[model samples]
Target: MSLQGNLTQQVEAYHNWKKELIRQIGRYRLWLQDNNLFSDDISARIRHGLELLVEDELTIAFVGEYSRGKTELINALFFSEFGQRMLPSQAGRTTMCPTELFFDRNANENYLLLLPIETRIGDLSLQQLRKQPERWVKHDLDERDPEIMREVLGEVARVKAVSTAEARALGFDEGMLEHDRNNPGKVLVPAWRNAQISIRHPLFERGLRILDTPG
Candidate 1:
């Protein structure tokens, strides 16, 4: 559903503000060139600023202890129109890993990308891993199919039973992991280290990113 009330107004205002800023900056850049009043460094800086403004994102992060309803809050705020919870929300640790919800303006297609937990065994950080798309599992998203979407998104809450050594290799502390009741000598860890969900939603399309972090 489209944004409503004051939020709608705010988003519109923000868009207008960005448009005006970009126009003014572009004008300034042209004026500087027309009058030969600025150095090359100044011109480059102004161009960079304009680019940054166009690509700026508004990110909202939900952080709290487990079972504090972060995922539920996200559903209520952004995914309620789906007629069901878009992200896993339950009485326990539903969001197993850090998940980022955003609209991929470049792709303009819905999809989910999950980075394996074992990626942590290497020295690469999450930001670095994001550049290596081959390391992530990709799933196409279809909002038209709620059941399939739910099932696909359910991957975010998945856990795998691993030996203590494997858990340590993934940089998970024993205290932070839950023992798998079904397996005596294994502990359960998040199957995925991180998740990126790209969807076409009004707010998300406007560069609004929502981050759900596990406790």
Candidate 2:
């Protein structure tokens, strides 16, 4: 089957599974409510426990240095059905920045959201970046062509030049500054801090968010 068709089947399976889970959780909630009539102390503990199961999105984060087979590990664990590497894995300096993959059930299409490195120099904090969608570059997903998928996802390797002074202000120390000295006045850095890709993978549809951080 094609990638999309495979993803759709996976997602459908996940949806059916989630429906059963929700039903069970709902029944548990009603049971708890009924038990609350028996005791005040027990009710507080049950309420606290229930709060943790509040149907929130679960995030799975990966952390490590460049290479070390981080992406390769993810590909093997979750994307093995591809029978190929789902992510671009290089031996060194691969996955230059963080990349997040998640499913947006409401999203009409798949795309990658890139926040420019320039955003770091501005007054906007990471939280504000989400609010300013205009500052991001969105690349539509093209799974039909392997080369296109490679090109779009490869944006994580994008780089830009920053002045020495500005780079230091962003927490770069002297050692890093000296190593990246380019023309005595600037330094080259990854063009983006993180990349968010929306795809139709089954894990994503089940609130499975994968964070491929600089590893």
lDDT of 1 by residue, 74-106 (tens): 887777778998889999888999999999999
Best by TM-score: 1
Question: What C-alpha RMSD separates each model from the true structure?
Answer: 2.2, 5.5
lDDT per residue for candidate 2 within 1-215, as digits (tens), equals 66546655665665576667767766776787787744677657666655655455667688887788878877776666656676778776777668888877877567899987767767878787887879889988865665677677778777666676666766555355323455656676777877888877666766777788875
Model 1: residues with Cα > 4 Å off, grouped in runs: 1-4, 30-36
Evaluated at residue 79, the lDDT of candidate 2 is: 62
Can you tell me which runs of candidate 2 are displaced by over 4 Å? 1-55, 78-86, 169-171, 177-185
RMSD of 2: 5.5
Backbone N/Cα/C clashes per model: 0, 0
